[model samples]
Target chain A: MIAELVLAMLFGLLLLGIHRKVIARIQRRPGPPVWQEILHAAKFSFKTTWVPATASGALFAGIVLVAVGIWTAAFFVMMTGGSLLIIFGIYMLHKIVEHAFGLSSGSPYGKFGGVRSVISAASEIPLFVSVAVIGLFTGSLELTEITAWEAVHGPLFFTAFPAVVAMYLVLLSKMPFGPFSIVESKELVSGYKTEHFGAWRAGLEVCNGLKTTVLLATFLLVFAGQLPVLWMVIGMILLTVSLSFACAVTPMLSPFDSVTIQSLVTALMLVYAGIVFTGVLP
Target chain B: MGSLGGIPLYVLEFGDELVYFSPYTITLFLLALTFTLLAIVSRPERQVDVAFGGDAYTTKIISVDEMRFRRFMAIACGLASMGAMVTGDVFNFTLFTAMVGITNVGIVAAVKSPHVQDAAYQYGLVALSATVPLFGAAALYAAATGSLSMIELAKGTLPAVPLVAKALLVIGVVGEGMAPFYAAKAEMFRAPGAPYVIMCSLSSLLIFLRVAEVVMIG
Candidate 1:
């Protein structure tokens, strides 16, 4: 568990650096220095914290802590011998708490951010379903069980290719690229994190990095299973690159359409059902 | 695509087998066809002008390129739907369904005029209505079967009474569909494009609830 936690944190920090650099390159501008995110976080951690007059200071801080706490917990859950359901539950709780923290801020931007958070949370379903489907195929949601299944069966994606594709889409929703990135765009001015600064700002950045790292890690665990440690590291690096590229290339799709959501739900459901009927889902 | 995140169970089991389309794929294809046909055939001669009402709002119309992007997304949806059908894995199928649903919502939002908030609202309602009962049925099924494997359920023949129950389940599904429409209409009065964001976010919950039902009931 300790090893996993350490590995997860280290990997997360590395990805943060990679994400910054890659995004910069994509934008065709001199991006922040590779270590800029780390330096910024360090600076903020040392700065004095601020609280708005109308805000619930303690609650605000508490929510941030909870967000980080849950993120950390999710990492451990993934590492430990827990079921997939437990890991997912932890993830959902973390997101909910993060949103609650956003709501604690009194600013209108903060309120809007909170609302966006709710919207983003709602968008998590298809991805969750994808994960659940993978669990079902293995006859166990336990990581170990899944890994063992992978080793013996040689990858569910090969047999259950549709699930693999679905998983990829779910991954997209979780990170929310393209049209799904409605929660954190500049229009909302960082959405929930708008009012945070100094150490709070730093904390959020670190948490965001951690969140991304955790997500990547979860994806790896689900898709790659027990690879050699060297392979794992290399694979993670590649994933970071891919994500950076994804962020760079994909047009940011607006989340302001009801039809977009409906379409996603309907399309995914119909396809899933069709797979079952055609004997592809087992 | 790499195994660093740990291999998914399906990957471990199947290992690069060619995925095939199934009934779910057909449904998505049909839906996509219907939508495309609607877009092509029902190109309204006069686009509705955005009339600012209630609170003052700023709205930006999506560009033609964005419309193309929606079509690209639709293609992705169709492909995902086909893939899910081929896999015969319930979890994958459900996930792809949700993605396609969300993508469709995005496409509709992009094409429709801001004045047509009612259309958006109706879309949301349909999503909610469709999802609720689908999930409810899944949950009931999971509980009755003592397993969450959708494949198992798919293979097992259902009793006639249960089939009726499942048919009646459409009511809740329809309610799921109606939810976004109402939500879209409500948001139009506040933020002009609020429905899009709300629907995107809701997609996650809707899919989650449905899967939870399947896991619990199936």
Candidate 2:
């Protein structure tokens, strides 16, 4: 488990660097080395990290720990091939962590970020719809069961392609620089993380990297299952690169716009899920 | 009528020695209990004396008396939510749902901002109107099945309910701020106290969860 966590964290940070490099290259600018995230972490570890005086002291500090804790648990779940429902639950709870991060800072920027986070939770509906679709297709919510089914029946994407797309969109919304990155957009002066500096910021970056890693890994295991370990890792990197390209091409949507788009997607996914649930598709 | 930690907790008086503790009720009860404890223990978002981006206002702080009252209302809301969750009878569930709405308004009514007061007023009016559908659903259920007890209905003692009653129940709960009706209560979150404001959202969520369980299981 410890090894899994360490590898996940490392890969997460590495993915983050890859994302930056991808976007930079897309703009024809020289990008930092792919290890830039590691360098940032090392630099921040040596610097002083202080709690803001204007902040809600306990909550401000606790939010980072909460983020770290939840993502760590998510990492554990992914590594152990635990129930996907548990993973989805943790993902839902991460919305609370995001809201807490913003609200605890007592800064208007943070509050805005928090509010955006709340609105973005509506995105969960579509994700839930996708989960239900996947569950219907596989006859289970357990990752092991889904993977086992995939091993015998081939990948679910071959049949439940719409659900795979829905899940992919949900993943896009979580990726850095994705259209729904309004929570930490530059317009909000880094938004929720505005007040979190130094080591706390480093902790958030690491958590973000872990979240990215877990999400990509989940996508691989859940949708593209039955691959060998070498192929699985390669598949994950390809996914990271594809997501980075998607992020680079798309501009961030306004907070309200993101919510609107998410809701529309959720409505569509719900319709698809309903059709599946009714046994109209099989 | 059951005992928890040696303290008798009244559920529904179905009859002598016929207590209801179904999995549906248990799930709602536990969810409410969890959020209630959270409302009590979670640290609130701090409202600072300073403002940024040239938007300046006097530092907003609730008086000790008002804070006490808000906390009381929040706890009351929590209790009402839990009540709505665990009730075995449809009428009692609707009654508790109405109480949850009332206490939800009361939780945020103490904030002095005109915006919050305006939002509370809007919510209060909606809550008042929502009771009609809520109680009407219960009445419809009773009239349709000759009983309002979910346990009795779940036992196949009653016929399946009219679709209208189910729809009404869901609409009534939604008007209490789930999704579409959430806009009415959005401004209420502007209230300076996080703990109290949180109850407004939490109660609605719990009630929604309970409603989903009730609709499917009952």
Q: Pick the candidate with the highest lDDT.
A: 2
In order, what are the TM-scores of chain A for the candidates?
0.87, 0.96
Task: Report the lDDT tens digits of candidate 2 across residue range B152-211.
Answer: 666665787886898799878866644212443456754566666656665776676557
Per-residue lDDT, model 2, residue B169, is 93
Off by over 4 Å in 1: A2-7, A174-179, A257-262, A277-282, B1-182, B185-218
What are the per-model DockQ values? 0.03, 0.18
lDDT string, candidate 1, B1-218, tens digits = 01112222342134323233322223223333332332332211111123456554332444557545554544454444344333434435444555545564554555546654456556655665565555565455445555334444443453212543344343443343332324334342122222222223233333333334333222
**Model 2 off-target regions past 4 Å?**
A280-282, B1-58, B74-103, B125-173, B177-185, B199-218
Candidate 2, residues A1-282, lDDT tens digits: the string is 788787788888898899889989997889999999978877877789888655656657766776787788778767766657546655665665676677666677776776677677755543566876786687665677789999999988787888888888888888878888888898889887888888888888778878988888898888888578789778888888898899999999987788888888888887887788678433
Report residue A174 deviation for candidate 2 (angstroms).
Answer: 1.1
